[model samples]
Target chain A: MIEVKDLSFAYRTGEADAVPALRDLNLKIEPGQLVAIIGHNGSGKSTLAKLLCAVLYPTEGEIRIDGVPVREENQWEVRRRVAVVFQDPDDQLVMNRVEDDVAFGPENLGLPREEIAERVRSSLEALGLVEIGGRLIEDLSPGQKQRVAIAGALAMRPRFLVLDEPTSLLPVPVARRLISTVGDLNRREGMGVLHVTHSMSEAALFERVVVMDEGCLVLDGTPAEVFRHVERLREIGLDVPLAASLAHRLRSRGTPLEGDILDGADLRNALAAVRESTAS
Target chain B: MLELQRNVIFGQFVDTGSPIHKMDARIKLIATFVFIVASFLIDSFLGFALVLPLLALIQLISRVPAGYVLRGSRFFLGFLVFILFFQVLFYPGEVPESSYLWRWGFLSISTTGLYTAGILGLRVIFLYYVTTMLMLTTSLVDLTNGLELIFGPLQRIRVPVNELVLVFVIAIKFVPIFIGEVERLARAQTARGVPFDEGGAFKRARRLGRLLVPIFISGFARADLLTTAMNTRSYRGGRYRTKLRQLHSTATDWLMLLLVVAWMLAAWQLPDRLLS
Candidate 1:
């Protein structure tokens, strides 16, 4: 489990009047849980992820991962335990080849050659990239390259995986694939996934959702509970999920359709339930 | 001849199971030196005929098509022809030693100048092919590694081997990126009504200046980002850097190296005409 107590961070631009990105954010995430943090463009979601990964140190307060505080001395160790996949593949990918790039993390960890090789194979296999392990990262499609990035993170064998708007720049199909894969990792392996996204549908994939606004945690609950605050999401310039929007419309029409619908499949099942009730 | 030169330069170094490609790059580097030296020693038609066949044999074993090699060689054909023409015109014709091959008014062409021109042409052509073979078969990483190994002793005097290799790698990496950027800039300029083609030399120079500003800015930005990324990954200087795939000299490598060395030594000892 990870705990953050009054964590606040500001960008040091060598100025006296620097504005804080994350303002007194208090959050606690349980182990083996997928937590979705959704926010508007400048809502400090990315800054929060960076702070969590120890990429940027906090200006004030404390962040404890497995009872160890993330400070300057323990920064590298913290990062080893927490791997972050950035939004841009180009920014994260350093090597020319896919296997080499994936192996980079383990290599830096100074693992034995056999262990590094095994990790590379397992990570690539986990991402369904066992065949194209030798291919150039540049030659792969965007979806494949993003998977390669995920494989690179997976190779690190980090307990906590933090992804900052990873699906924001991807196409719908690619985004869905990424979400499913991340979800699978969280569910099957108990890999703690902290997915930072503005997509309401992506938030629905996670068990718990944390909605952030103006550098503050505004709403935090299960998808159904959090999404029920529809006007609040809209007021913060965030779009509600299609099913939730439709469910709200139907609810206004006095139909007994469930307002807990987040995905299309959920809506379909809800409609089936309505039909079954009417038939009975 | 010009066309052949271009083909030779351009063709050859793609990945193939060629003997040259399979050989250690260090040996190939040494062989190329010896080959270049042997070509310069070749002075006469007989010498050229002998050396040309050897070059052909080397190419055959390289497994790269002779036609492709010659296609690459064509790029430098213009320069080769110019050199040959200059030599033929400038070399003085001694009378009575050899009969005039051709005579036009005050100008007389003798066998001596013709022979010299032929030898020079052959030497140029052979050297070009040998260099192309070295480049085509060897990967950039291998070439740099070999260079570093050869220049390793220079590091004792603080010659900055790693820095030099870094420069070479960075140059190779940025060339394509810069070319793409230039293409984009040229299109942008054309769209803005700047006629790059119609400009005079000075006007063209001005247009190039305009193009360079954007390219430099973008290149600098990219370089900053790449530096940050590389540093974050802990890629310091190349000192004590262990490569995952290392270059090792095999039996074939040694054999080829020995053959080239023997040929160079024999050519050095032969008579001037034979050597040529």
Candidate 2:
């Protein structure tokens, strides 16, 4: 399990007025749990992601990966437990070829050559990227490149995978596919996923959703429970998923849509049930 | 109009499933250094003639097309010709009266000058080919590993050999990236009415200066992102880093090393006045 306690982070901008990016935030992610963190720009979601991977230390409180506190001496251990995939795949891929890039993580960990090679093969196969393993990263499409980035993280054999807005640079269909792949990995491998995104639709697919506003966790629950707060989400300048927004409009118009609709299928089933009741 | 991608092939690696390509990169690196030094030692045309068969044998073993390898050195070939012209025309070295072919106001041509120019051209070509072959066969990762192992001893003297190798490898890798970036920037500037190709040398250079600012800024931004990415992947320099592909020398590698050493010895002992 990954745990954060009263985490607060402040960046020193060399000015007297230093504003903290995160304030008194606490979170825990159990193994195999897939959670999404959604917020508007500058809401400290990315900062939390960075902190989870020990990229940036918290000014107050501490983060722990499986009871090991994140500190300087245990950085490699912490990183080995939690691997991060950043937004831009272009910047994240250090090697030219896909296989070499995936091998980078294990290589850094000083694994044996045979073990590193095995991890590279397994990671690429896990992502269904074995065909492009020998291809140059520059030649791959953005979606493929993003998959390569994920493969690199996977090769590290981390228990927790933190993706910081991984789909921000991808096209809609590509993003959907990539998220589905990530979801499959979480389900199959029992790896905990902490996905940071701005898309409510994307967050709705997660097992739990955490809403951040002004460096504080404003809402946390299942997607069905969280998307029910349409007004609060809009007030924070965050959009609810399309289905939830539609359901909210119908309820406000006195159509008795009695439940939170977090996805298209949920809205469809709910609308059909309402029609049957009205017809009866 | 900027076909920069097609034109810039120097230092680019081509994967040809050949024996030479499969050899350990450290072996190739050392052999290349040895061959280059031997090339400089051989002053006679007959020495170069003797080395031609060996070069051909390597090319055959590498399976890389001769034309493809030669094409990468096109730009250097032009520069070599320019230098050879100057050397032959000026004839800087002392010339015997009998050997002088022509002389006019600090410009002279002689038999020895022609021989010197030929030898110098051969040396340049040999150096270029050896280095180019090394790159064509070895990937950047192998190059980095080989260099670090080769220079591993220097770390005891407080030299940041790992970081230096990382910097060198990154710099080499960035060549194609920056070339593409420059192409994109030039295209954008062209769309914005900047005439990059219509000016004289100074004017073109001034126009290029405008392009450098954005490139440098973007380069810095990329470096920042790369550092974060690398750190996240647990890259803490080369202090305790292990390689996925270790360099193991096979029997063929040892044989090749032996052959290179023997060739260097022969070149050192060969007669330099074979054609004189």
Candidate 3:
């Protein structure tokens, strides 16, 4: 399990003045958990993602990965478990070609030739990138490049994959497909995922959602429980899923809708049930 | 905007599955060294006459188009002409008064100047051809592996061979990426009415200078990301890194190395006096 206790972080802009990015926050992610953290700009979701990956350490508190405190001396332990895919694919990819880039992580671990090759092959196949294994990264589409970046990260076989808006630059359909793939990887392989995104629809797809506002963890539960606080979310410059917002609007207009609605299917069924109950 | 990726093919690989492309990168590297040495040793035009046919033969064997190969060098060759013209105009080398083809206050062209400039130009072209062919045939992976292994002995003496070779390889690999960035910036400038293509060489050069600022800024940003990405992947300067692909030289590579060595020796013994 990854544990964060009273974690606070700030970026030092000057010698005396420091900008607080993450206030004292506490969260726990169990093994094999799939969670999404949603927040607006400057809400500290990205900062939390970076801190979890050991790229940035907390200033006031501690993060423990599998019981070991994440410190500079034991950073590799944190990194060995949590791998992050950054926002831009161009920034992360070092190799010219797809397969080479996938193999890069395994090669860095100083794995033997056979193991590295196997990792590269499996990573490429997992990301459905085997066809373009030999193609140049520069020639790939933005979607393909993002997929390649994810594949490179997956090659490391980290227990928790932290995706920091990996699909923010992609088209909607492409982003949906990429998120669906990550969801499948989570369910089928029992891999942990901390998908930090601003898209509420994408967050709604995950099992659990964590809401961050002003560097504090304001809400944490199943998607249904989190999306129920649409007012709080809106006040923090965040939006709930479209279906949830529609359902909330209907309820406020004196239309009774039952149960916490998160996605379109839930809203549709709830509205149908309300109609059926009225007719009966 | 230019076809920054497609048009720049001189240093890009063209995999033909030919024997030359399949040869060990070490042999190609050694052959390139030999060709550079031969370019310096052979002072006679007749020597280049022999060397040119050999390069052509290798080009044919490599199966890349002759037109494309020549097109790759067109811009460099144009610039080379201007350079050689200045070299001949200055005629800084000591020349007999009777040997002067044309003479002015500080501007002169002599037989010796002509000969010196001609030889230097040919040598440079030779170097360019050999290096370009090496790049066109060998992939960056092979180049890095070859360089690391070639300099592996220096590691015992505390030289960071693997890191140095990786730095060199990454620089060459990013050349096209940066070129594409420049092309995009130029297009942006043109869209904003910069008159990029309407200028002479001097104006074109000054305009090109404007693109460098953003390129460097973007380059640094990219570098920062790449560094973090590399660190996140556990890259520790390649100290304990084991390669996924190992280099294995073949008989054909050995034979190619032998042939190049022999040719370099023969070219060195060419008679410059007879050509004069």
Per-residue error at A66 for model 2, in Å?
A: 2.9
True lDDT of residue A103, candidate 3: 83
Q: Report the lDDT tens digits of candidate 1 across residue range B139-227.
A: 55567678778777999998999668756655554544565577688878888887777756578658768887899998888777555
Q: Tens digit of lDDT per residue, candidate 3, span B1-276?
A: 434555455557676678887888888898898898888888877778868768888999999887887876776787899899999999658866899878899999899899999999999999988998998888777888888888899999999998999888777777777877888888898889887776688987788889888999999988887888787877778786877777789987898889888876666665554544
- lDDT measured at residue A245 in model 3 versus the true structure, 0 to 100: 88
lDDT of 3 by residue, A1-280 (tens): 8999999999984548898999989999997899999999899999999898888887989999889887888777888888889999888887777888888888888899999899899888888999999887877999999999999888899989999999789999999999998888888767899999999989988889999988999999998888778888899988887999898889899999999898889888998999999999
**If you score just chain A, what TM-score does every candidate get?**
0.94, 0.96, 0.96
Q: Rate the local accuracy (lDDT) of all candidates.
A: 0.76, 0.87, 0.85
**What share of the reference contacts survives in each candidate?**
0.08, 0.79, 0.65
Pick by DockQ: 1 or 3, better one: 3
Runs off by more than 4 Å, candidate 3: B1-7, B271-276
Ranking by lDDT: 2, 3, 1
Instruction: Report the C-alpha lDDT of model 1 over A1-280, residue by residue, as the tens digit.
Output: 7899998888874589887788999999987789999999889999898888877788889998888798978876677778888787766675556887887677667667788888888888888899988766656888888898888888878888888888888999889998998888887778899999998888988899999998999999999998778889899999998888887777778778854788788888888988898899
**lDDT, candidate 1, at A235:** 96
Q: TM-score of the B chain in model 1?
A: 0.69
DockQ of each: 0.18, 0.68, 0.68
lDDT of 2 by residue, A140-177 (tens): 89999999999999999899999999999999999999
Q: Arrange candidates, best TM-score first.
A: 3, 2, 1
Please give, as one word, the docking class of candidate 1.
incorrect
lDDT of 2 by residue, B1-276 (tens): 455665566667778778988898899989998998898788888788778888899999999888876665675787789889999998757856888888888898889999999999999888888887888788888888889999989999989998999888777777778878988999999999998888675797688888899999999999888888899899998876788877888998989999988976776666554434
